[model samples]
Target: MEMERLDRRGLWMAVGAFVLWGVMPLYWHLLKAVPSLQIIAHRIVWSTLLVAGWLFWKYGRGWLRETLAHPRAAWMLALSGGLIAFNWGLYIWAVNAGHVVETSLGYFINPLLNVVLGVVVLKERLNRVQWTSVAIATGGVLWLTANYGSFPWIALSLAASFGAYGLIRKLVGVPPVRGLGVESLYLVLPALALLLWGETHGEGGFVAHGGVAAWGWIAGALLVFGGVLTALPLIGFADAVKRIPYSMVGVLQYIAPTLQLLCGVLVLGEAFDRDRAIGFGFIWLALALYAGDGLLRGRTAASAAAVDT
Candidate 1:
């Protein structure tokens, strides 16, 4: 009973963290004064600082030694970092451009991408229902493309990038915080170079216009918030994974994107055309099938385990 209660707590924590992440566009809206690229640079720079400090505090010199000891892992993590950076930059640009609706659509489509990645990259087999879900989702995307008369490139790109990032992270097999810390370190060099160039070329350097108080502090604050939010959800996810079955956690993963979708349609006032609605409907049906398949498979697996025990 106590264990079950703890699982519930962890689950709720995961949900709350995701909810906070989902509503992030509202916060980004306030930072519209800054250019998107500049904001992204700040995000990388500040998150790097925060993650570096936390790693040093937690692991002392051992963290550095371990990272150095595994060059392959380090390189993999660095590549993963780049992918996430691109994802963040694009997401920031999309939000600032008032495409939150499409952004939400991207995340909604992401889980399906995850399933595809699992099948292709991990050599995992999807059950019939899961396969059907993927097919349905593909149809939805096609419908949307036809409706728009051109591909919804932004949405597709966001989903692809983020899904690829997640796959890379899974393949790397490092602890989430540790992996992210190393990736942030990897990003630091290019970010510094960009900041330098921006300082010389544009008025967008963190604090180039004024010493350090101009808008650097605000950027720094956003970076800190982003890092905290990023880290918290990751920790919550890890915790939930330890406590609950993957089947449950997998289903709950949709909560964040669903909330984002609601916020996009209701709060951001993004329109959903007829074709887009049809597309979303197909996607929703696909998710339902995928989830139903998982539940059934989980039950069968549990029963087999019981019989064996």
Candidate 2:
């Protein structure tokens, strides 16, 4: 009973996290007037403060000290931090610049990219079905590119950067919250410098010549709340990952991009013509094939183990 309850909680947490992520474009749109880079800077600054405080409160100074003392871990986290920062900046810019649909496409393609990265970098092997799905997804992307008259660089960049970040985190074996806290710390100095430069050049958004009220105070409040928005989903995801099977988590991942696609097409009134529909259709079919193969393989493996036992 207890285990079942925990699993249920985990499912809800994971779903909530993905839902929040899916809706994030709406939040970023509210700060559309702010430069994406500046917004990312503030995100780094505020998230660092909040995460650092949480780390201190939860584990005392030992966790931070130990993490800093491990030179290799620190270096790996720094690299991952840079990748995530780049991803965040690009995603924010894309969402506010009317590339929300493209961004969704990138995330939809991310799991396949992760599988490719695993095969190439980690020497993992894929079955025939997995390879077929990857091929289909590739075709989908190619179709989109050919029809759109150019490469989908925005989507590709987002997928690659995030995939790389996930790879590094997996290799490093760092606890998610502490790792995020360290990553935030790694980013703080550069972010602060950028924010300072923006303010000096009259480009900052939270404040102006008059006061906080000039930005309606609501915007200022939202900018500050960006830290909470950044951290909360991560916390939920960490909790979910700990309590649920990774395959289930993988299945749940689609919720985010699906919601993002809906937001772009329905809420934001983005252009979604027949060409896009065809491209996305192919990708969706590819994902369905990929997921079905995974579940079938998992069941087979479990059955074999059961028979052996």
Candidate 3:
């Protein structure tokens, strides 16, 4: 019962996280005027400050000491931090550059990668149905890539970085918030330095000129809000991975890209004509196959356990 409830909580957390991620294109669109690198630097700097303050208050000093005492966790988060930073930079650039649809395609491809990684690294097994679903999904991604015009380096990079980050966070023995705080800390210095150089060179978006922000006060506020937006979903994601199977978490990720696809087509006015739609259709079919099979299997296992008891 306890484990069941934990899984239920994990399910909701994952859903919430994906939903937040799906709608994030709109948020990034608001900051399209800002340079992507500057935006990412602000994200790291502000997110670190926010998380650090929270940790300092809660743990009352020595928070860093506690986190770093675990060298393995620290090292893993350093790698994850760098990966997520790269992912964030690319994602924001893609959104602002009008590649929302292609960005969605990248995330659409991530779940299959996650499944393979889980099996290879964590020894998670997939049945015949799951393997079939994986093949279909792979076909969908290939179809999208071949049809989407230019090569999708942005999409592939985003997918790979986030997939690896998720796997590492899942394996690390640390609380979600604390782990995120530490990850932010790892990149905060470089992020600050980047912003400093940008401002000094007059290329930054957040600097104030004549007591007014270069891009207006609202944009500055939005830039700071980026930290909050980025951290919340990630924390929930970490918790979800801790409580549930990684493969299931990956399948559940379909929510994010689906929402992102809609945002790109409807809100952003991207060209999502028949060809793109057809490719997305194949991916959707695979999601349904994997998700339905998992649900059916879960019910069967629960019923069998009840009978045994």
Best by TM-score: 3
Off by over 4 Å in 1: 1-20, 193-220, 234-254, 299-309
**Tens-digit per-residue lDDT, 220-279, candidate 3:** 899899989988899899999999889888889989999999999999999998878888
Q: Which residue pairs come into collision in candidate 3?
A: none
Backbone Cα, N, C clashes tallied per candidate: 0, 0, 0
- Candidate 1 TM-score over all chains jointly: 0.80
- Report lDDT (CA) for all predictions: 0.70, 0.80, 0.89
Candidate 2, residue 184: Cα displacement in angstroms equals: 0.4
Assess candidate 3 and give its TM-score to the true structure. Answer: 0.93
Model 1 lDDT tens row, 182-268 = 888888888778767766765464553543346566755765576566556655654554555443443455666667777778887
lDDT for 211 in candidate 3 is: 30
TM-score of predicted structure 2: 0.83
lDDT accuracy of residue 304 in candidate 2: 88
Candidate 2 RMSD to the correct structure: 3.8
Q: Which ten residues in a row have the lowest lDDT in candidate 2?
A: 205-214
Alpha-carbon RMSD, each predicted model: 4.4, 3.8, 2.2
What does candidate 2's lDDT look like per residue over 1-309, in tens digits?
588689879889989988998999999988887788888998999888999898999899899887767657888999989998999999999999999998987876676666666677766677788678778877876777688756789988987887777667656656778888999999999999998997787677666633333566676678889988987887677677567654355446667887898999999999888988888787778778877986797679778878999
